[model samples]
Target: MKLKVCGLTKMDQIQELISLNTNFLGFIFYEKSPRFVLNHLSLEGISAINHQGKVGVFVNETIEKIAEISEKSNLNFIQLHGDEDENFIKDLRKNVKKEVKLIKVFRVGETFNFQFSIFNSLVDYFLFDTDSKAFGGTGKTFDWQILNEIEIPIPYFLSGGISLENIKNLQNFVKVNMRENKTLTKLNTPFALDINSKFEIEPGSKDLEKIKTFKSLLK
Candidate 1:
């Protein structure tokens, strides 16, 4: 499983996460988020990192604005954590020339469905997170069992309430789910695990020791 550390803000915290060789690092651009990074870190500073390219996270942001931030930040990926429609993402991709990966995040709830056939063709990947009216960084876990009922054609990342204490349990959950339905293997997909608020001491401030210890388990 690939590890993605989200809600990055400080340069020191960014460096620490890079040292862990995390697969992806996310920077929140949403102004409302307590973990917002656009005001704290400059585009050049984030691009200077030698490892783990940055991902710009946005919520209900305009396409022009997203494009501007992506260029200025030199972001390698965009994670849409808002209620962006499929047409919006299609246009955003057409406007940007960079080899940008698009990650569309869906907030899971009791009625949440994984009808990938509707939007899978538009974006590169899906990120499942817990649903909250305010949007991500809620640090709450939705039922992992819900994933078993959906059909995801593209690769995805599992987010929401993930922490050091529950990661092993999550892995075990996936393994057990796989055992129950052998057809799931036919999906032939690589699911990345996204870790956010749980690894932080506070909003935008990550706990390196906690991250390192959690990563050690993967090894």
Candidate 2:
């Protein structure tokens, strides 16, 4: 599985994470977020970061702004962590560069039933996270078993309360799904893990040793 360390702020930490082989570096554009990247680094500063997995996360943001930021910062992926519908996604798709992939996040709470056809072509991936008023980074996990009831047509990133101690249990989640005959195919497991608050020394500040251990644990 791949690892996406979200809410990056420090340049040194970002470089170190790249050295540690973090698959994705998430920069939150939502101004309300405590880990908002722009608060710590300028757009030019972010643009200078030498990494292919740079992901810019947004919540109900304008398409023009997203496109502008993506171009200026050279983002490889745009993670929409809001209630953006198919029309918005289609429009955004037409506006942004073709090389930029889109990851639509579904904040799962008690239940979620998506009409997969709408998003299958609209996005490159799905990101499942805990539902909270503040938008992610809550360090609270929803029941993973909830996924067993639905059929996810696309590969997805799993977020919410993922810590070193609990990551080992993901195998069990796969096993349970397999036993239920729900998935032994592409949807068998999450393509990546989107980690945030759990490994942080403080909001926007990550603990490198913890992240390094998490990466090794994934191996």
Which candidate should be chosen as best, given lDDT against the real structure? 2
**What value of lDDT does candidate 2 attain over all alpha carbons?**
0.89
Candidate 2 collision pairs: none
Off by over 4 Å in 2: 175-186
Q: List the residue pairs that clash in candidate 1.
A: none
Mind giving the per-residue lDDT tens digits that candidate 2 earns over 139-216? 988889888777777888999999887877876886676677554444846788899999999999999999988887
Count steric clashes of candidate 1. 0
All-Cα superposition RMSD per candidate: 1.9, 1.8
Candidate 1 global CA lDDT score: 0.82
Q: lDDT tens digits, residues 1-219, model 1?
A: 788888988998787777778889889999998988977888788777666457889999999999988887888889999988888988998877558889999899876755556677888888888998897777988888777666677788889988877877787877775677567434433377788889888888888888898888876
Error of 2 at 196 (Å): 0.4
